[model samples]
Target: MKRLKLLVTLAKKGAIGEKVKITLRELADELGISPQSVLRLLDEMEKEGLVSKEVLGRKTYVEIDHEGLAFLESLCDAISEALYNGVIIGEVISGIGEGAYYVKQYAHLIREYLGFDPYLGTLNIRVLFPKTVFDALCGVRPVVLPGFTKDGRTFGDVKAYRIRINDIEGAIVVPSRTVHPPRIAEIIAPVYLREALNLKDGSRITLRVVKG
Candidate 1:
């Protein structure tokens, strides 16, 4: 399980760079493994050239190799598909009848699985992974669904979904503005709901869940 996580980390980061600078103690905590186990994993990864370590004075750092990055991305894409339920829980913010908005802070960070539409240009979803699923993946990787973009990168909204339901029972949202465009922020993935939203092949524009 611990070995699997290191591999996942490599896959997600693309490349770990020449000097991966997390302390041994931090690494252990972040990976949810023992420090001793970390040493073992690092040793194995170094042997494989999946990672390379650098020592600066008394400090040590490690980063993923190019080959390791490629390997991890493929694995992540596959795991993402099979790991979670298909049903996605969210609301379309822009469509909200009048004056609805998801708080910006909630939308931007990995607090909850909130979903907002482009209507707000940002979103937040309370992380809603089930305890069982989340627990199983405890050390598999740090939280955050695969492929979510922060850092002001925009794709062609190609992965859009035509949400069929307007179930805003507990969904909260904010409106659009110049500084903050509407977006899906708070999103929850109920297994069956996610399965139902099982995106079809080549379907673009993921459903912007938070909409007023």
Candidate 2:
């Protein structure tokens, strides 16, 4: 875990697939370890082909290899799968009054792909713990909502995941273009979830994935 943490720190320093100059003392301070320990860990990582280091005079350059990035990705997948497990908790929040317009545009596609006629608007939820709704939904396949152009305006594709909230079936839509933050989850159901569930702003909700 120490090695992995060190690798993560290096990646954060813009060392992925590109050389970045850094000092042992800087790395040691970031990792809360001694410079000698950091050097030993880097030696092991270099031998394992996870990182490559080049020393020129007094400057040292570091880069994360492809294998190192893959290792981090696999770790992320494992953690997401273990923590999320197709369930998400959040609090209901209001949208920016644009959900109705976008939902109207994608109504046909939603009915065709998700098998439900979505209501005019969406229910916005602020994800509780995970960094983003996309991260929380990692490892779960999404129903693709293909984009189309109308009246010279192009709409980007979206990813949807079927979920159940309080026994009401709905799907969360993630747009290719969004002004909302990663924590916001936009949900669409056959009916208005707020009225149906008696939900108000700050209402806590649990969403369970419905496997197709």
Give the whole-model CA lDDT for all candidates, comma-separated. Answer: 0.43, 0.90
Per-residue accuracy of model 2 over 1-212 as CA lDDT, tens digit each = 88898889988899986999999998899888999999999999999989999999999999999889899999988886788777888999889899999999999999999999999999999999666787667778899999999999999999999999978999989898878899999999999999999999999998987765
**Candidate 1: where are CA atoms >4 Å away?**
7-15, 83-88, 91-212
Of candidate 1, the 10-residue stretch with the lowest lDDT total is: 155-164
Model 1 agreement with the true structure over 1-212: per-residue lDDT tens digits: 77668766543544355555656776688798888888888888889877887778978777787767777778767776565433343333332322223223233432343343223322232223322222222223223222334468531211122222234222222212222223233322322232344433222223222222
For candidate 1, what is the TM-score? 0.40
The TM-score between candidate 2 and the true structure equals: 0.69
The superposed Cα distance between candidate 2 and the true structure at residue 14, in angstroms, equals 2.0
